[model samples]
Target: MVAPLKVGIAGLGTVGAEVVRLIEQQARTLSARSGRGVQVVAVTARSKAKKRKLDLRGVAWAKNPLDLANDPGIDCFVELMGGAGEPALSAIEAALKSGKSVVTANKALIAKHGLRLAKLAEKHGGALNYEAAVGAAIPVIKTLREGLAGTSVHRVYGILNGTCNYILTRMEQEGLSFAECLKDAQRLGYAEANPSFDVDGHDTAQKLAILASLAFGTAVAQNAVYVEGISSITPEDLRAAEELGYRVKLLGVAVRTAKGIEQRVHPTMVPKSSSIAQVMGVTNAVTIDGEGIPPITLVGPGAGGAATASAVIADIADVARGIRAKPFGRPVEQLRVTSKAPMERHEGGYYIRLMARDLAGTAATIATRLAEQKISIESIVQRHANGVDTALAKGKSSPVPVILITYATSEDAVYRALEAVQRDKVISGRPQVIRIEKN
Candidate 1:
């Protein structure tokens, strides 16, 4: 019989512990599938005394995670320790340097240091697989890196963060306020206590950076992404979207444009009939638009211990079967450093909501400002102040809610026109602008 593939797991947290359980329970089946027995030989975590559900049995305990990475008895290092800093980074680096294959679910670590790690792994004659990094259990990374390798990918986008998606879904479906929905999400453990990392669009941006690299053959550019969170989304906006035959979703969108790669994360109005708009709750979805094939969308549970562990195990099985591929679908050294397509050059329709003063010619002035920028209005709707607020009706000059949908226009034109409107004081307070995404 062939030697069993020795495994060392660092950070026995939720996903890590589940991985151990699944490996033990499915050992015989995994051996049959991969043609090699996969065994857990060593483990390390922040707390060994912490009560766990799994049986460690004869597994060796390493004092440090790096010890497991450098252990000669271990053939593969599984990194479940998530973070962009210390221990996880150093240990994974050491593992690659020692010619040991690695599997990780850390999106932040991969987004920030993937190219360097890929080069390290290639130099050491070892494999680096991260099927669990992007869209947990959805197989998005594998689909892009291997399954669609022959196609010319034009665009890749998705709802990468479950917390933001959950909040937005509840707000639209239940008419709950952002804060109310966020509180409920926190109670349900869908969002973190702080929630800034997930709610502020940084999490989606990190995942987008990885997907953009895979889709466009560019180096990961997390900083280049224009991030706008879902905090600004109101119940009123959701209602307006529904009325306009659209659904408001926080999307991480990347496309290869003539200017360069356009990467952005923000609240977008997707058509109600689109498959992406139908995905709700904590579920995640990714759409790949490529050449020679219709757009393919992969949707599933984006996060959780079991789902993420399943993806990690898939990567492990591939490594055991001697399936080695470049980390980002291609060699790291060959990945281009493409320029970021300027957001101002982005061409798309927009939904603008304004509080117009109920004075004479208010609508005319607004129209003239937009027309001066050569932006044509597709539709416009106005409601009386009485319908919006009773307090506004009692004021010296009540302000009415005016919503406008514009034709495809440059972002620079919209910004310039809105700025002029603000300077002229034709509208009260800040105007709400949401981009309209046509599927």
Candidate 2:
């Protein structure tokens, strides 16, 4: 029998602890599949004394996670300690430099410094695998790096964050406000106490950056992504989307355009008939548009201890079987620095909801502004506010809610038209503009 692959895990948090339990419980099957037994040789955490469900009878303890990285006995280092800095980054660097295979579920670390780490791993004859970083258990990383290697990918987009998805789903299904649904998400433990990372779209941007690198063979550009959070998404916006045969989802999209690579994370209006619109709750779905094939969509649990651990274990299994692939599908040096397509250059349909004064010529003025920018309107609906918010129904004049759906137009044109409308004082407040993604 071949020698068992020794594993050292850092961070015994939810995902980390679950990984240990999974490895122990499925030892026989994992070994059979990988052609080698996998063993948890060492473990480390901030509070080692914290009571855990898994028995750690035989596993050695490392006082510092960096110790496991350099330990000659350990063949692979599983980094579950997430962060863009400190011990997580330092320890992964040490492991890769020492020629030990490294597996991680750290999206921030990967997004910030993936290319550099991939180069180090290649230099030291080690493998750096992060299948768990993007979509937990979705096999997205593997699919882009291996399955679609031969095809040229044109676009990659998805609902990457489960918290935002859950909130949107609840708001649409239960007719609840954003705040109400956010509170429910917090109570259900789907969102964090802060919730800024997930709700503000940074979480999805980080994941999108990583996916863009893999799909487009470009360097990770987190800063290049145009980010727009779901904090401002109102119940009225959801209703407007539903009325137009669309559903609201916070999506991270990356596309190869003539200008360059366009990456953005924002609230998107997807058609009700699209596959991505059907993915609700805490689930995630990714759709890839590649050459020589129809768009392929993969949907599954985007997060959770078990799902993330399952992806981590798959990377470990590949390491156990001596499978070594380039971290980002291609050699790190070959990954080009693609230019970022400015958001202004983006061309798409838009859903604009505005509170216009119920006065003559106001609607005509707004339409004229849009036409001045060559923005064609697909449909425009004007409705009266009957016992709506006091703010909209202020004084003797009730503000009318005008919803406009425009045909494909440059983002610059839409913004310019909205600016003109705002300057003219035809709109009461900031107009809510949501992009329409037909696919």
Candidate 3:
């Protein structure tokens, strides 16, 4: 009989508990498929006295994660804890050093410190698998690491954050303001109480760093990458984008430019009819670019308790079947970690909103400056402000909100032209420029 591959899981809040449920439900089939049976020997969480539905009667329950990590019977350590530091970090370090395979769904940890941990795991000859980390149950990590290994991937971008996508979709469909859409998402449990991580694009930024590193064979850099949130996205922007045949979606985008790699997370304008533009309401999608094959795209629920656990189990089955692969597609040394292209050199279409005087020559002045920078106007929309144009204006000198879409231009050129327009006496306020990602 094949010996059972013992498992030790930490953080049973949501994902860890789901792991137990999956393992119990699929034990026999997994044994047959893996050529070995799997056993849940131990679990760790903050509270053991709390009620749990699964059967833990025969399994050990540790008050602390370290207990599970150090257990001799545990041949593999599963970390479901959601942070980049603390017990999760310590436990993973302990497990790898103990010569045990480690599986994690912690994208934050992986994005922040993947290369270091990969080196340690390789030194110990134990697998450091995180298929669950990037896209839940999607196996994107494996696809990039193995399936597409033979190809040279040039760019990897995705709509990785569920909350932002949900909110943006709601805004478009219901004509709801950013705040109202966000409130609806919160009420539906699609967003967290503290939604900054998702709404502000930090969550997707982490995932982007991970995916970009895999695609480019480079070390992931989460903090160094530029980040922007969806909070400033307004209903006006949404309506304007729609009228212009565009959709504003919060995208986690990464492109390998000649200058270097450009990584950013922000609300971008994608064609409403494009594949990525149609991925609405909590659904996730990733697009990969490379040489010779059709662009590979995978879309799904990037996060869910059960979906995440499914990826965890797949990694464990690999251990059971004695399968091992590179932590991030290639050897750590061979990974190309280079400086990304400066944003100034990037050329892409843009959406801009500015509060300008409704007087004559104001539009002409704005146009002239953009013209000097070679920015061509594609579309424009004029909307009266709530009070700026009403009770506050002496006459036609009132500042009306003007929104415009521009054809693709270099980032540097746009900023230079904007500087000139901002200083022009004809303009009344600062300009807000949002990149249009028609990728």
At residue 193, give the lDDT of candidate 1. Answer: 93
Which portions of model 2 show Cα errors greater than 4 Å? 386-396
**Which candidate tops lDDT?**
2
Task: For candidate 2, write residues 27-95 as lDDT tens digits.
Answer: 999999999999999999999889998899989999898997889999999999999988999899999
Query: Which residue pairs in model 3 clash with each other?
Result: 217-336, 261-340
Q: Could you report the Cα RMSD, in angstroms, for every candidate shown? A: 2.2, 2.4, 3.0
Q: What's the C-alpha lDDT at position 61 in model 3?
A: 81
TM-score attained by model 3: 0.94
Candidate 1: where are CA atoms >4 Å away? 385-396
Q: Give a tens-digit lDDT track for model 1, residues 193-259.
A: 9999999999999999999999989999798899999999999899888988999999999998888
For all candidates in order, the CA lDDT equals 0.91, 0.93, 0.85
Clashing pairs in 1: none
* Candidate 3 local lDDT, 83-137, one digit each (tens): 9888888889889989899999999899877898888788888899999998797
Q: For candidate 3, give the lDDT of residue 315.
A: 96
Deviation of model 1 at 289, angstroms? 0.3
